[model samples]
Target: MKRLLQVLVIIFPLAVICQPNTEVYLFDLNTTGNQINITNGKNISNNEGYDNQPSFQYENTILFASTRNGQTDVVSYATNNGSKKWLTDTKQGSEYSPTSIPTTKDFSAIRLDTTGLQHLYRYRSGKSKVLLKDLKVGYHVWNSRNMLVSFVLGEPHNLIVSDLKSNLNIQVDTTIGRSLHNIPNTNLVSYIKKNKNEWEIRSLNTRSLETKKIANTVPNIEDMCWLADGSILMGKGKALYHFNPKKDTEWKIIKLFDKENFDNITRITVNKQNNKLVLVAEPETTLKPKLENIRWIAGNWKGEAFGGITEENWSEPSGGSMMATFKLIVDGKVNFYEIETISEVNNSLLLRLKHFNNELKGWETKDETVDFPLIKITKNKAIFEGMTFESIDKNNMIVYVAINQKNGATAIVPFSYTKK
Candidate 1:
């Protein structure tokens, strides 16, 4: 790739949505109106170990943490070529709840270091830097670049707003849940407070730091995501629920994930496209999707990203898998190349890819290709377990690849191209 074509952008912070410790799945929304019709469900994280806490980096992109390699770091999936890549590869400790910080091209998550201390970190260009310290943040959401509302782990587990610029902490309430979210196109952030046997949904004004109760969730739900029109979607034992504070006043059962299809679910998130639902479920019960569903990725595609022209060729899905190769040419020479494969793990589609150099020497050992889980698949767009891809039309496509380098720097690589 052409090193001179690099452009940098900053993004977000980590959002520790909920800690249920389960497998994550992707659900497609078939019908969207007053209600949601989600069908063709599939598991994203098919690993035997812990895979949870998914967050959207964009409408077509997703970022999450997985313990597939015995330690927790961030990984992303691209729906376009069915490719997966590692965002954060650290030996320190595990990272969680990767959330966008707003008004930037960077993102952050909670890092529990070897000493058992939790800090909020900002990641860019394949590296990570701590944004806040000394405060054990179990969960967090940023209303802006400076103001953040977090479910902090403390003597009583308080909800506090910390001003990054002034370094002041203001407590909002106590005994709150881990689901912290930003209501779209608004300055308000929402959180759940345990109210007796039920949980109440409350809104916080980022500017004033004032709080108000807006609605309540179904009997027992700790994970939820917002729809385009400000409706709330939550998941309980076997079904999905929704509550519209603007139209209805009560929590109602709306969608269900059958025991045969999914189980032991945790954390819920919607991709930026706002058409698919993400669920964290028990790995044992998660289902696999069909290969024909992603046949759109079987072809030769070319794009410009990471300062060079990137060309990738993929085979049609067959024999339970597909194969592909990647090359980034700078000037007139190849800078880096890659080998990729897409297949099924447990019961879900899994994308694994390994990077290489100009001499065809593999960058990663023969045993590993970064793994990305399948998030959702659409006609023109598909989100793998991590990043996102958008087809403006059949002839053009856009891709975003989030990279967290081993050196502790981070970058979100952008690609643009026309079908050749």
Candidate 2:
């Protein structure tokens, strides 16, 4: 029969290429509430505005930290969108963050000029070279064979090993204090934060400058990202720890939220193509006054985003649930999202929030549009902010909240989500 139907059409396309492809995402750099959902993960290139620190350029092509066009540059993307490049641009100040050196074609950026002092630049093709000037690199990294250049310089915070072959710069001895970076390929694991800020999860050995303090108690580590099954993903205080340095410790504690009043777990990012886990839960105090605006948000909440760009899942889906219903509905202004998800393909659910200071402080959201701008409505809590567009000249700013204190503190925006 025609050679068994040509071997079942070439073995059914290799069993659909060995089954794999279902990413769906739309928020990273830390996903907060106000209806920002993504299921699966990985799909960033819309609202490329305010895009901060994303490495990897040539496969899913990326190199973020952007202000789009009004300033603060360093942009490039090609997850297949074809072209959207701008290596670096600055008529002056603004450039603050950008890191990439993982399997490298070369990348590193920092141009915070204007006296805040931070002028380190190094781009490849489009041209732009500075490397080190004035000095004060807060958090910079580049390894995986881009040569070598780790950071966290001066002012009571050392550990700045440099060496682009022979330019050497050494400064190890990380007794570590106020640091939240340096963990890209184990140069000696990092995520420090001493002097009462609490955080501990260290591992320094700048070839043996020696430093070890892996989890002396993590209540809010806020520093993670080292997974390819090597597990090191973290997020403390409220809960979520998975350390496992080859069985040297903590293998799991996954998720746990509901601590006094939230705020302390500053950041933790990891999307491993979509295993999903991005948090930024911080709120030590903003005068929540007597917050209890909607009786601890009642119930019913869910999150998962990014379902475009050829569409599949993207990365934003993995056992989802969030129930913070009603507090300030129609008669009170607007703040309602009832999302439900399931995907063999698609299940409509979009959320949006982009506020880079429309008087609402700082906010960012992108799942898929949900109208914005409402600012305040206290009784249970309701605050808003908005602004969007990643490409037409970047302009992101999304913030949302509908707090009602119990564990309540749900609407606070401060921009810092990065994924492209």
Candidate 3:
């Protein structure tokens, strides 16, 4: 147990603090004839905190891990009326990857306790018992009443087949991903076989222990589900793609939820009847204010602004601030100078600047300074109230400032710079 905990904490952290805020969405799926149509999409897990790993518990019920009281637990949602029921509430541990057990009313999930003991357990009416005590099962699926295939956490996670009837465990494959499901209308189970250059969806024959590649996955996407007609569905960003191994040459986009702002799509599953679909995604959020997010701006930069050559030297972030000095030169003479600082204030960022003439005459009063509070931050842009800093690459950048004109209007002026 201790060794298993060490592996889990190193490879995949189960703690609540490490999880991101996400939601689970349900959609009505229609795969009639050659085309597919998805409609009536709704967010089933709409609460705050982490909610993911969705699976169909029954024809009209969906099971997933949801956050409540600062910890994750299994929750079931009804597709008919949008109702929910908590299945497990443990104070010292959390449950994830809940799935229905074949030929039984009970379900199973992987539980991670406070002491770092991770194992798969079966949940009955109100009690639970460990299903696989020795292996730290990250995700699993039931092949039949007596057979199970699990993705066990390890140095390179292994895919194991456990027979409950004979108490036998066999390692079938290694270096696999978490998405696993029984292929419909076949005696095979599907799993992701990860490789160095690409990942492929492969099938494992439970009887012969044979494996074969089905198709290469959508680049870096591991989560997927099988339709009733043996077609596969996978989500990436805001788009859902479909692949038919028999006829399709490559994965093709079937639906795009661009207007929904449902980004980072993962962990998708379809119901047994192929009429319902559930997916997990992280919604777009405002970036938090942190100097670490914009530390790439610290360097010597030269650019052109105001019809002259401008230069700025910035200090690395320290003492809750980053300081810089800017100078503008034109016609072989120093035009003006500016002193600037971006400081941490009240849990946010505040940018302040003071302007001076070439001869050191103050343009503003002794206490007056231009201020621009931080608005948001993206992967390459740091936006303030009236100013923005955009990094094009390691050696190039652009700064856009709102400048007041003589006509009592304001215009955005761009300053392009190259790192020195």
Number of the top TM-score candidate: 3
Q: Quote the positional error of residue 412 for candidate 2 in Å.
A: 20
Local error of candidate 3 at residue 333 (angstroms): 52
Model 2 residue runs over 4 Å out of place are 1-42, 45-122, 127-162, 165-180, 183-201, 205-208, 216-420
Which tens-of-lDDT digit does each residue in 1-420 have in candidate 2?
A: 566445433422211112222111223333343222223333343442334445554445556554545555666666545476776666655554466656657677766543334556776775667765545555666533433434455445565666555666677645454334545545654646454656576666555556676664344443566654444665543334555666655334443332223333434455445334434443323223222321232222222222211101122333431121112123333333222221122222122323333233334354543343333223322232332111111121111323233654333212212222
Per-residue lDDT tens digits of candidate 3, residues 228-321? 9898999876567789998999776666563464667989999999999889998765456888888999999999977899999989999999
Tell me which of candidates 1 and 2 scores higher on lDDT: 1
| Number of the top-ranking candidate, with lDDT as the measure | 3
Candidate 3: segments with Cα more than 4 A from true spot: 1-8, 11-17, 286-420
Overall lDDT per candidate, in order of appearance: 0.71, 0.43, 0.87
Per-residue lDDT of candidate 1, residues 1-420 (tens digit): 132112100111232223335676776774454446777666666666667788877665677788855567887755444356778877866788888777887888888765445688988977898876767787888878888888887556788898999998888799888899999778898999887777888888877878898887765676788887888888754446677788987665555342234544568888656777777876432223656766666777898866778998879988999898889999979999888887866777778888888888887887867988876555544456454455566677655565666765434444666767
What overall lDDT, based on C-alpha atoms, would model 1 receive against the true structure? 0.71
Clashes of 1: 35
Better candidate number, 2 or 3, judged by TM-score: 3
User: Residue 237's C-alpha lDDT in candidate 3?
Assistant: 61
Each prediction's TM-score against the native? 0.61, 0.25, 0.68
lDDT of 2: 0.43
